[model samples]
Target: QVYVNGELIGGCDITLEMFERGELQPLVEAAVKVQEGNQQA
Candidate 1:
């Protein structure tokens, strides 16, 4: 499973498919944005 900030985002089966379709990049980018926002806050 994939976890972001200790929250489950998806499972390996779906995540792998997303990775193949290049869909996971956006999720990772959003996670980074959220982390940066939290740090700034």
Candidate 2:
């Protein structure tokens, strides 16, 4: 799930695209990294 400013903004579930371009991979990874960084702060 994803949210912004305490409001649920949008999200996505497992899909076929993750296996195609591999673009989703980096995005998911980067998003997690940023979220972890935010929580740590």
Scanning candidate 2 in windows of ten residues, the lowest lDDT window is 7-16
Using TM-score as the measure, the top candidate is 1
lDDT of 2 by residue, 1-41 (tens): 55433444345543344436675657667778888999999
What are the per-model C-alpha RMSD values against the true structure? 1.6, 4.9
Which lDDT tens digits does candidate 1 get at residues 1-41?
89866667689998898889998888888889999999999
lDDT of each: 0.86, 0.59
Candidate 1: lDDT over CA atoms? 0.86
TM for every model, in the order presented, reads 0.73, 0.54
Please name the candidate that would achieve the greatest lDDT relative to the true structure.
1
Q: After superposition, how far is residue 1 of candidate 1 from its true place, in Å?
A: 1.6
The alpha-carbon lDDT assigned to residue 9 of candidate 2 equals 33
